[model samples]
Target: MRNASDLPPEAAEASASGVERRARWLLVLLAGLLVASAAYLLYARGVFEPTQTLVLVADDAEGVSVGMDLTFSGFPIGRVRRIELGGDGYARILVDVARRDAHWLRESSVFTMERGLVGGTRLRAYTGVLEGPLLPDGAQRQVLRGDALADLPRMVNAARELLEQLKAMTDPDAPLNASLREVRQLLQKANGRDGVLGVLMGNEADRTRVTAALDDVRRLLQRLQGVADRADALVQRTDQRVFGAQGLADDVQASAREARDLLVGLRATLQRVDGVLAEVHGIAVNTRSATQDLDALRVEVEATLRRVDGMILDIQRRWPFSRDAEVKLP
Candidate 1:
């Protein structure tokens, strides 16, 4: 290798110049890379994105810090940018919400800070009505704090009360124990000679009375069955007498036929009587001129009247009931 001292001065100067130029170019490239990386980091952090401010007031901000996310539906929508104690002794949390994600919040949005038993504090936002008016920028709202540890004392008290109730239940003099004793006595009674009846009737005397009553009911039912059988026989005999051959129904039919024949004969007799009455009326109208024919007409009327009397007597004989009948000449 040739030493630099043995080279010409211009060549050495040119070599030095080339190395400087390369070093300058490398520095320039590194500077450009640094600027690009910074720009990418700023973009990723959303430093240039348009945002709205939301102020949440809380009584305490023990676990909340700047850079904490305000989540909506388990997704981060805003970031806490500042926390300050207000003059009214409240902790005010200022959040920067991206303009795009701010639409997820509404006037009805509720913000909460929750500190769980096994995890870090979480900030959450809930919007119930999507159609509500949008939350304006720089709107100050109250934040609700939910701490699992805060309910420890109340839960402990409730657990103590439950344990006390269990202790009282196990005591010998407790109502539950007394009830159990009564149940045991009832079970013993149910297994005794009277069985379940003894338990229901509450005493041996009452059980005996109930048993006697049940036996009486059974005997009465048997008597009623015997009575029902006798009634059925009686109904059979009545049916035979009322509707059998040569029974009351047959006699009634015969009487009805005879009565019908009598009615026909009586109708014919009434027609003959009507003719006689007409002849009499004619005689009465011309009594002077018809004096000789009057005796003949009277004889004819007497014959018709005799026939009517015979028909009435025949009707009275055929009928089931009889009445005194007499024919008189008018």
Candidate 2:
């Protein structure tokens, strides 16, 4: 190894070429890496890709920032590149959505800015139907916000009202307390000897009166059962006297049967009398044909007497005359 200053200026430069060339090569590699890193960053930011623009208008831009991701279905599809005030004093967010992901957005898609309790603001897209018409480039849409912090005042107010209602209900002077006291009294009454009836009657006197009335009703029902039993026994005795084998009803039935037989005999005698009457009528005609004098009349009278005697005989044959039979004196 020679001294670095031994050669000429140009030669001296060449003599230390190993370390110098290595350092130069290292710097070139570092520069290439830096350029590659910059290209990668630009690609990631979608600066070099073809993109469609969408403008979102909102009332407030509290948590929105440039370079925020616009997510669709939990995947990033666009980036918010600018935020500014519009001519109408509304916030405008200009977003750059890649061409490939632009198809995911629809004309009916809803855009929103939401800030959670812990995270930064997020831009979101909701496409209810993927089959709808595609969202046009450079379209302006309204942004809806559902910021957790923004809703805090309303939530606090609702919570405060609820607490007030709860406190009012728990207060000693509230109607709920009165109802509870009434329920407690009712429960105590229900636990008494009268049970649920005591609670319904509300006082001891009324409950006692109701219990006495129940006892009276029970006694009345028992008396009615005894009366029914006595009535049943009387009916049995009457049945034995009127309808048993050697009872009054049997004698009455025998009398009725004899009376029916007498009536039948009387009806048969009446039929014989009618037949005799027809014969007498024929005899009266014969007498009128024979003579209109007393002789022929005497013959007709004899024939009529014979027919009447036959009728009498038939009556006797049907039913013999009793000893109490009477002959009327004409």
Measured by lDDT, the strongest candidate is 1
- C-alpha displacement of 55 in model 1, angstroms? 0.4
Model 1 agreement with the true structure over 89-111: per-residue lDDT tens digits: 99999999999999999999999
Clashing pairs in 1: none
Candidate 2: residue pairs that collide: none
- Count of backbone collisions in candidate 2: 0
Model 2 per-residue lDDT at 163: 100
Query: How would you encode candidate 2's per-residue C-alpha lDDT over 1-330 as one tens digit per residue?
Result: 777777689887776787889999999999999999999999877899999999999999888888899999899999988999989999999999999999999999999999899989999999999999999999999999998897899999999999999999999999999999999988887887779998888788998999999999999999999999999999999899999988989999999999999999999999999999999999988888566587878999999999987777666666656564433325
For each candidate, the alpha-carbon lDDT, in order, equals 0.93, 0.91
Error of 2 at 198 (Å): 1.9
TM-score of 2: 0.62
Clashing residue pairs in all predictions, respectively, total 0, 0
Best by TM-score: 2
lDDT of 1 at 170: 100
Question: How far off is residue 303 in model 1, in Å?
Answer: 31
Candidate 1, superposed: residue stretches over 4 Å from native: 1-38, 221-330
